[model samples]
Target: IFFRSAMALQLPSELWDIIADSVQSDSLAHVCRRLWDLLGSSRYVKLNCDSHCVTQRVRPLARNVRALQVKVKGPWDPTGAIDALQHAPFLHTLTLSNMAADVTVGSARAMAAIRTAPSLHTLTLNLGRNALGTDGAGALAALKDAGGLRTLSLDLWGCAVGDSGAAALAQLKDAPALRTLTLELWGNAVGN
Candidate 1:
């Protein structure tokens, strides 16, 4: 009796496209780098700006990015995050994470960068560390028009946002294509 060997089948590009499209944008980096390597040239990417060597890492994938997130591990300049906006013309989603009390993106440069990102439609700002005061909220509210925002999530855990700040965020709902909104304002002084 003789044994037969099994043949390996390579998946088609269309099937890969479907799989890639189904992946949640937030879960990209966690999906294993090897899988991304297997996908080769056509693999989509999201900019994850952490405390690592961000400059080198971002330059290459900047053009292909569809979504972007800036997470500060230590003291990171807001300008670095703002500069990234210029490279990603195709970017549609952005997440700015400032997990430190001393750091805030309330700079004019950052606001200008947000204005330039016409393709941006989704925004998630985790401004828990730095207090996203009413001023901060107002600045971000202007971004609601950036690419006709579709989704917005503000994790203002320690932000001192009273009625006025919340009021500003409310304007985001009036955005052109807004479909989802999340507000986390724990320990805030928002009175009814």
Candidate 2:
């Protein structure tokens, strides 16, 4: 009936463009993939996706992307996602948000992988509402070895890391490339 007729008609070019733009505006990651497919090449200069989707999609688009923002959902296994980021050879900025403290053990592997990204200049991890504690901070501090990293931000607004965690993060003071550091702690105490 009407549905069949509509399906038979070819969509006008203008109509398709409208749809594509709508999709792109709705979700950055989806737009990246769609543009990649439509242009037969990659065109995304910046990208934002959850850790899981990034692990699944970023490898193919890595060569063309310059900046990346990753939001990790709670209860995540940091190792797999971190390994996926390592595959991106040209990434310059990385933002990890909503990481779970309970997953720190697996995150060690991710930390190791991040240490190897030659182009990563900025790293931000938001543990604001999760479980990352002193141990987790210690593990993240290990990234000081990443030669190109120049900026780091850690947010632990609702966690249980006290002075011990602050001490661990202080280790970054010696990082040769680190030029900026930001730490946010709300519900935790770090000796005033």
The 10-residue segment of model 2 with minimum total lDDT is 35-44
Off by over 4 Å in 1: 1-56, 105-112
Per-residue lDDT over 28-47 for candidate 1, one digit per residue giving the tens place of the 0 to 100 score: 32344543554333234444
**TM-score, cand. 1:** 0.67
In the range 1-192, model 2's lDDT, one tens digit per residue, is 532355523545455444544444323224345433443333333445555565566566565444566665545566655666666666677776655545563464365468677678888877675566777667777877788889888776766667887787788777779899887877877786
Candidate that would win on TM-score: 2
lDDT of each: 0.62, 0.63
Error of 2 at 71 (Å): 2.1
